[model samples]
Target: MSEVIANMSMSLDGFVADTNDGIEQVFGWYGSGDVAVPTAVEWATFRTSEASAGVLRHGLATIGALIGGRRLFDLASGWNGQHPMGVPVFIVTHQEPTDWAHPEAPFTFVTDGIESAVAKAKAAAGDKNVAVASPTVVQQCLDAGLLDAVQVDLVPVLLGQGIPFFGELAKGPVQLDGPTVVEGQGVTHLTYRVRR
Candidate 1:
């Protein structure tokens, strides 16, 4: 069987991106090296230092396919050949893409709805796990009772205001399974095993 999981890094104040959609606030807080992996030993010590492969470690370990919206899909275009999972990714979008570089990644764009996207992602995933990359899409999975777990890396900083991990939810009574904290190179990782 396969499972659907969602993961993202957020700030202590609960914002994913800056108010202007600029992640500079996020990147600035870490200050130095890659946001995914820090090179400084002290920064690593600040983090739990359990994993070293960046988000790829968790994503690849738990999922065979990744699903996200147009924004994230475009953002990942630069890493076409550097995909960590080496699996297919389904993008949920209305506009069709003209360029195709990571053709090997097996991207399927769904315009119908989240259901269609999830169905296609699962099909592509087969027996492996599927990841809902963006918060919006992740919320859809959660609303449909399709998501299995949620993992968030809680970076130590307050964003004042910005795009939150979970924006306006459709409905609530939302519950969370205990969160496990893991210190990374420059950021603290939090993993939650959400439940009903």
Candidate 2:
């Protein structure tokens, strides 16, 4: 069975990005250590603590597809058509981008909604997990009762104000199960299963 998981690196203040939508403060751990974690793309590689490297390796091996919002897709410039995971990507948007450069890439622009995107991503993922990479999409999945787990790479920082990893949920409070914790150098990886 495929699970929809929301994954993000967030600050102590619950912000994933800075006030200007910059992730430099929160994403420092990606290059703050000595261990090298290579991805499918040649241009992007992570240098992190050995513990973090193990987590990254596991994610790269297990996650078979990705779901993201248009904002994040634009922020990363579509990851140059190849995400680090090298899996298929499903973008949830009201309308597809007209100037998308990589039509041949395994990227699907889902214009219907989040549910449709999740369905498509699950199909693409087969038996593996589908990772939701955007905060808005994560919130939507939570609201729709479509998410299975939440993975937070908790960083030690307080942005005071910024783009949060979670916003107001339409469905209000959502319960979660045990958070299996893994302590890293500058981050603590926490994985919680969504309780049904």
Candidate 3:
């Protein structure tokens, strides 16, 4: 059996990505130094905080598979054939992109729905955890009672407007516990258990 965990790094104001502005500000803490066109590996490996790196390492180690949304897939187009997580990723999308269907790519586009995507991800994960990295997918899982835990790396910044992590919770009011707050250098990790 595998647990479904939704994780994200959000601003203090609860914004995930600053819409047209992008997520560079919200996630700036993840990386450091400016380079002339850094590779996807460099983009993924740069770390400003060792604690944040530890958290990410722990997450990647515990999770066997990842589930994301179409927009996220598009944003991470640089991953191409090699993914940073080194695990199969299930992407929820309305339609599969033709150019993205590489045989060597560790990605599966689930056109059916979030549940179907999650089912496949869980199967792939086996006894480990299945991580939902997209906010939309996380909300869908929360609504459908498919999410087991919610983890947010709370960054100390205020994005006036942007994509939010929570939207139209279909399951109504979801009670959270612990929040198991851990203070890092640049971010605070908040882990909450979704009460059924």
Taking all chains together, each candidate's TM-score versus the true structure is: 0.77, 0.98, 0.90
Task: Return the lDDT, model 3, position 20.
Answer: 82
Better of 1 and 2 by lDDT: 2
Best-to-worst order by lDDT is 2, 3, 1
lDDT of 1 at 1: 86
TM-score attained by model 3: 0.90
Model 3: lDDT of residue 187: 80
lDDT of 1 by residue, 90-139 (tens): 78888768787755556677888888888888888888888787778887
Point to the candidate with the largest TM-score.
2
Candidate 2's TM-score:
0.98
Model 3 ranges off by over 4 Å: 32-43
C-alpha local distance difference test of each model: 0.69, 0.94, 0.81
Of 2 and 3, the candidate ahead on lDDT is 2
Q: What lDDT, from 0 to 1, does candidate 3 have?
A: 0.81
Q: All predictions: root-mean-square deviation over Cα?
A: 5.2, 0.7, 3.4
Model 2: CA > 4 A from native: none
Highest-lDDT candidate: 2
